[model samples]
Target: MLAGKRILLIIGGGIAAYKSLDLIRRLRERGAAVTPVLTRAGAEFVTPLSVSALAGEKVFTDLFDLTDEAEMGHIQLSRSADLVVVAPATADLMAKMAHGHANDLASTLLMATDTQVLIAPAMNVRMWEHPATRRNLAQLLADGIRVVGPNAGDMACGEYGPGRLSEPLEIVAAIETALGQGSLTGKRILVTSGPTHEPIDPVRYIANRSSGAQGTAIAHALAALGAHVIFVTGPADVPPPQGVQVVRIETAQQMLQAVEAALPADAAVFAAAVADWRVASSSGSKIKKDAGRLPVLEFAENPDILATVSQRKADRPGLVVGFAAETDDVIANATAKRARKGCDWIVANDVSPATGIMGGTENAVHLITAHGREDWPRMSKQDVAARLATRIAQALG
Candidate 1:
């Protein structure tokens, strides 16, 4: 997708810096010409020699190299690339860019360049949530810079809660989305993701294996196509796309409320794996276990979010899409789901243990519409997302 693209890769200092080498190789494999610019601290984590070797290009380190300056002016060097990418963008670098500080080659090139800047932030959980970092991130977004990852996982700091850089493949997907032509421009999209946690008590909840990858990717894909996205997600492993308005929820009831509030959208994709049942009367306090007997729990059906939206009298989206995760008769179930939900389309995938679709990277789905079922070959969730986004754009148009 990035064939012939000129990519300026700026590696930042962080434990995630090693991942940048793989990023460089992947970019090159995709026909992207990479120019590595290593920050001093970044060099501490990953050697310049490895970066150069993987990128198949010379690494630029010094901010003021007389020889480099004579060959290619700083201004020219900064503007030479079609896109500027900062992988493992540390807190320090983000702050510098936010404040327009140019003490180093990376920051200087950032300030001097007119090309689009895309960053994949990597930091400790605390640093990521700090108010100052939040402010800096907000400012960067306002400045129209693109950001990816900072996914939630066990951090190098031995703590958890968001701050991990996206995987190399995920970063590549983000870059592709950023560079792709805007196909959904002027469209408004609503997407729901993740597995709703049905609370049984303050500390206990029932959830699913949904990581929200497919839905999140769809939201990013739609946003990349120029759609203003409203992403309603439950607890997810990945951060919401940078440019979208994310409405976070916990329980299925909460998700329904959030989705309803985000009505009047051009299209709505109900990709969330909302729990079918929730505790009928959740205990206010934790239920103590008794050695003699097991605790009894009552359950109630959760709201049918897709059906409600699809059958809305007013402000119903032009197109409503639902998802069916089935172990058998995937197409039939999906077709029936589309009819039952009154949604315009349904994406059905087999999540049987044998298929390994749930919580996995690739997905094989059937797109069931009013017209007919279109079976798609197994592909990465990113590919499905891109194609779905394009299809939504065309349908809206």
Candidate 2:
């Protein structure tokens, strides 16, 4: 996927700088040409000779190297690559990138670059969790810089949280995503995930068993395909995917409002297991137990987000996909549901306890459309998401 790509790699100072060498090898193996820029602190960890040898390209170090500037101006070098990648992006580096500080050659190139930037942060757990880091992360995201990972695990700093740089292959995957020329590039996609909570009291609420694994995977797949995804998610078992516009909501009504707010997209996928009903008269406080006293709860139908969006009179999405989690008559029920909901397609799955699909890692589903129904073999949720994303790409194309 990364063939013939030009990547300008900036190695930041950290214990994780060693991994950047391996990253260069991985990128080269996939036919990507990497230009190395080693920071002064990064040089303390990895030698310029090593980086140059692995990258098969001259290493750029000094900001004012007369020979380098004569051969290729800093501005030219920065604008030459398709993408810029910062590996072992330490706290100092992230803050600089976030705040636009260009004191050194690497930071200067980062500031001058017109291309997309991807950073793999590596720092102490406490530094990673600090308020300043959080603020910088938010700023970077807002500035359209893609972040790979600071995966949670034991750190070299003897602190454990989220400060480990992603593995070489994981960084490669992120690079591929950044440089992909997929069909969904520049497309806007809306995706809803997880189960909604309908509150009955201050502490009590009703919800489904949706783990949101499938929806999260779908959002990741869409983003990997280069779609600008608007992810509307509810309280979920797993964390949401990176590199997407995430909108968190708690209830079906909130989900609906969020979905509507993210309108005029090329596609919308309603993967959330929204409740069918909510308490008509929810209690403000906890109900006390008393002898011969009973509390009756009335039910009201929740807003059908899928149906409403699909049947919109204006600014409807080009493609609207809904999910049907049925235990019996799966295909038949889903086929009817697709028509009833007025969606372009319905992905139906057997969520019975025997299948272990609901809240499970794998899924077996039927794709229902106006054309017909196609039964898909059981596969990991990630596989399903990739397939669905590809299908969406094809449909949009």
**What digit string (tens of lDDT, one per residue) describes model 1 on residues 22-81?**
899889988999999999999999999999989888999997899888865677878999
- The residue pairs found clashing in candidate 1 are none
Clashes (backbone N, CA, C under 3 Å), per candidate, total 0, 0
lDDT by residue (1-397, candidate 2, tens digit) is 5679899999999899999999999899979999999999999999999999999999999999998789657898899998999998999999999899999999999999999999999999999999999999999999999898878789776888889998776687677666653668889999999999999998899999999999999999898898999999999999999999999999999999999999999999999999999998889999776889887889999999999999997889999999999999998899999999999999999999999999998899899999998887786686678668867877998
lDDT (Cα atoms) of all candidates against the true structure:
0.90, 0.91
Model 1 local distance difference test score: 0.90
- By how many angstroms RMSD does model 2 differ from the true structure? 7.8
User: What's the C-alpha lDDT at position 68 in model 2?
Assistant: 79
Quote each prediction's TM-score: 0.61, 0.59
